[model samples]
Target: MASRRRLFILLAILALVVGIDTLERPLANPDEGRYSEISREMAASGDWITPRLNGLKYFEKPPLQYWATAVSFSLFGENEYTARFYTAFCGLLTLFATWFTMRRLTNNETALLATGVLLSSPYFMALGVIVTLDMGLTCWLTVALAGFLYAQSDGTSEPTRRRAMGVAWAGMALAVLSKGLIGIVFPAAAIFLHCLLHRDWTLLKRLAWGRGIAIFLAIAAPWFVMVSRANPEFAHFFFVHEHFERFLTTQHRRVEPAWYFVPILFFGVLPWMFTLPSVAAASWLAERERRSFPWRRFALLWAGFIFLFFSASGSKLPAYLLPVFPMLALVIGDWLARTEPRRIALYLLPVVVVIVIGLAIGWGAPERAKSAWTRDLYGTARPFIVAGGLVISLGIAGAAWLLRKGERVVPLAIVVLATLVFVDCVEDGYEMLSPRQSGRDAAAVTRQWVDPSTRIYSVNYYDQTFPFYLKREVTLVNYVDEFALGQASEPRRSLPTVAAFVEDWKRPGSAVAIMQPGLLEEVLKPAGLAMILIHADERRVVVRKP
Candidate 1:
């Protein structure tokens, strides 16, 4: 493919991704919901210095996501679309940057294949729509990878390679600021491993150590220094707890089996998952001389290192493996350039089962999770969801047939991938994120009774999603206030436990408490806590004491 045609194809892929990804409502999962809301609060408060979680100075991850969302809040005035703005943009850049890099590494054929695989990947498309740190870190980190490849590609001389390495190093630093040390950590390890495997120490020595270190410090230091200085407690918790503790401990207890990423890599890269084997094989086969084969070993190391690296850690989540996505694209791109026509059908045959499984799961997700209300949220377009499922299933099968026939399916493949990722994952899965709460619906129930200054509490039960929707600080009595205190740090910094809630219970008849049903019987009954009907769900019970 010529440069213009390749550029056109890239643009086509970008359009498809952005369009499909735009379908999701800002379904605030516990984390994204809470994070976006906190960022908004900080932006509102004009306190950009101390990073607040819930309302506390949460010294957890670095503050870039919050800062990025805050900036989005500035332009669009704080909604789901605005909160997700930066992530979506980063997601596009990550996709395209991989394309450009892969093209330079091998050829346009490989680049197109990788872009197709990326366009279809579920994790990348799903996380791309939400307000999260994964996309931002992935973009800059992928950009750095691309820069390194540009540095190593055959004709680049020593000085130019050095400059490219400097660019890569600086990219790593910005990525570090975006997420944390893992930004640079995984890449550094992968590059070292790549060198070891290939016995090429030339690239390692090319980095202008003094100048590169200075550039990195210059790009990433400002935020860390300023934010740490203001928060005071950021260094220990961010470095010690967020990085070291999160990787090693069961504190979050999110451990998954060794094969956790297997299905994710399998399904998360759907539609293209069918093509991945060919893509990867081609990538490996492309290997030649040490420096001549840019896509060969480096791509594998980047993908495997990050995937296995996180897998070896104690805590695990689907989004943690995002950094490896571009490398996966790189490998698949290389594979595609070398894939034979006869082999395409082999990849397509098994996907009939995969799409069937995806349909059942995607269809059941809404019914089981009871996110049916979102259909109304989307108005008349609600029925389109059912259509979307069928469209996706049929689309996958249809696309597979195209790939099997060795038809030039760059466009058809693009559409199917985007639909599977955005429609099935984000559009339908948004409901499972935050349970429907009376607190979220408080305006409807408490509209008449609620004064601007009315006292409110999410007693005995703390759903971080509630206060975010309610747009005010609601106290918690005798529950997990750590998460709540993490969000809202001021006014009610200290929360009482059950014993303390018992001691502090007053029949003053002026407060409302939301508790789980079982807890209500024990905590309120003895105190003769009067009740006003507010809201009740399987998990939470709301009682306004009179």
Candidate 2:
């Protein structure tokens, strides 16, 4: 009863952390804006078949995330909280999924500990509320992984095994729909690697491949077939260009060092990092004492594959490492559930030292920035840092005292609460970065001047946040990144170059173009065009012709 109560309290705390201040800040550029804008269009147009962005057929990603966000918009009425609600829900889903899986593998204490570890991880919590497709993909991936792990155990009844395998297949399908081929590729590789390591050929036959494949095709195929049929170009662009080319070439210009994910894995799993090495080692050794299935080995293979896969990819992003975190949390959670409280406190000392150093470095950051906006952003962020640091320091002190008093769960609670404080601070400090990075304020200023007849053009550069905030599509003028294929098929709405846009500028009335500040002063200003600067910011400028 006490355990259940503690679990409920932890969940309630998570709900508060994920839900509060969701609308306190504007969406960040590129990823957040791009995704939220796509969902905005998806809901507004009521076109579930084709996923469009900036009023173009956007096939860069599958429509599952958009579908979720669109539904949230329908139920809640479009706003930042609504746009971000699904992602936060997915985060909660991941925690529950991890806890349930851990319970199946171990016990209630381990399950709760795993859930807390995941909930406390800074990157995991931050990504949960941010508007992005990664969380949805990560959640489904967690489902598939947990189900597979549960299925692999022979101690379960035949019915349970069958159900677990069914879940694995369904998860793989949803994952495919959520991202791409990787949904299937990642799990398949992990399963194959595990089977090879254990030399367990019988595991393959146990997977109920016939029923599973039917389930997979049923859930994952219809959209692909329909979208491909509607747009003949989707197959090649989505499969070859996005999947193959993105993996094989640096043409996307997202190249990073080969060891990029090394730090991501190390720091992304914070507070728990100090004990992970010892815990992971001890857990593996303990598993070897029994003749049970190699679940630990399978988890390592799962996380290791994701790390190695993205590490080898030509393009890399930090969030690509998200799928690996759940596995790490499970491992650490199991270890934490078994270890002594006082020893756990000893393991946390490194985290305290790191936090102190990070705060010191942050305190000096404002002086290093060149611009007033950047210095102010740093200055504004300092309070949140200090507040977070103070909360964590006190929490650590409390946790250590509780551990000395032999109060096991209280220490864990203190650590989790401290992590939540840091998460809140980060979320709150996000507003400081808004002016330079977000199009929210600029869009508000632009909205005052724009009317139904006013044509908006994104010239040379596109601020992803603009369309979502303005709640309308802006014409792209020589500015298609992933939209190139869409633009190629329908060139009517887009101008091919700045020269072409200048020519089109003479024929328009109340046409406002959003462009980079550099482009505005360099090209449009020298042209002596009758362009009136309507809205200006560090990153973008909105200009009108009088």
Candidate 3:
């Protein structure tokens, strides 16, 4: 009972830390700003059916997260916290689901440890606070996996099995809503691979497909139906272009070597990466005795397959491998519960090496900066980076000493607290880089000069956070990068040429334009357009027609 109480307290503290950090940083573009603005527009426009960006139709991703965030905005009024609340909520919920699932599969000790592993993981915690579809997708995927495991686990009554399968189906449905087809595809493929390897055809027979399919369609189908009916172009764009082309081609411009996720998976788990071999061996050997179900093997298959899937994709990002981390936490948790402190102490050595490497990188970051402005920003951030590294190193050293003293539980606590501090420091440092990466400052300046009647033009580029910060859309001037589909459908929404934008700029009403400073000097100046510089930053220049 005391242990449970302590665990609950620790979790509550971690939750508070995560919640506070979500509000501390401005939204970083282009992903954070892009998603937040989409949600803001969704709330403002009251158009829940079709997702739009900058007041134009945007069907690049599904609308589940946008809906959740929109509802948050309506309740809290738009701000960084509200924009990120759903994602942070999902992250916490994912942690709870992981703990509950592991408790059902193994024991309370393993469950608690598993939850700790996930909470302390840098990548998992980082994504939880950042606005992105990845964490939302990871949350639902974890739920789906948990529900499936519960349904299949030994000693589950028939009624409980049916209900668990229902939960699994609903989770997949919500996953689809969160990020489209991969929600269903990943789980289905993992299950198939599991059954194929084990020759367990009976598990398939027990899946309750008739009821499951109904539940899945009931939750996932309405938005797809409504969006498709409202916009004819959604079907091909969402299904073929977004999923197929995104996976098979590099058209999204996110291509990387196939081994890209290899390092990500290694470092993403952090402090626990060294335990993988032991965890794998222990899980594999232990599952040999369980004839009823090989839960650990199934988890391994799930993580391995998904890692390989994203690694093989033509488009890749570090967050793409987030779904695998929950499964890893489970296996690693089980290993931690049974392993000795001496063996665990051995793992701390590699972590010290990582901390040293991190310090070196943090100190050298300013020197590697691309511009004088960014170099100054990096210089300002260097101390925070060093502080983060020092925090982790000291904690790891203390934890190692505790392990040598045969203390187990307190060492884990030290490490979790240390990692949280490290993450907090890194986030603080990241905010310092916001002057270059975010448009929040520019947006604030633009907000001072413009009213509802002012026409705003984004000439040649778009800073994703600007619209969210300003709470208004800018007209596009010869900018059709991600907005290509939106622009094609609504051609008049964007100005076609610089010459044409200059014509629009000559109109009588108050007008402001945002462009790179280089573009203003080389393009607009050469064209003899008269402008008053409103604000200029390292990344963007906001100007007004005079």
The candidate that wins on TM-score is 3
For model 3, how does the per-residue alpha-carbon lDDT over 1-546 read when each residue is reduced to its tens digit?
Answer: 477648656765875675677565888989999999999999998999989999889998999999999999999899889888999889988998999999998887778888888877888887888999999999999999899999999999989998999999999999999998999999998889988987787789888799899999999999999999999999999999999999999999998999999878877777787888888888878877666788888888889889889988999988899999999998888888888887798998688888788788668879888888889999988888799888988888888889888877678777788888888888888888888888989999999889989999999999999999999999999898889889889998999888899999999999999999999988888888889998998789999877
TM-score of each: 0.86, 0.96, 0.98
User: Candidates sorted by TM-score, descending order?
Assistant: 3, 2, 1
Q: Model-by-model lDDT, in order? A: 0.67, 0.84, 0.88
> Model 3's lDDT to the true fold?
0.88
Better of 1 and 2 by lDDT: 2
Q: Which numbered prediction scores highest in lDDT against the true structure?
A: 3
| Alpha-carbon runs more than 4 Å astray in model 3 | none
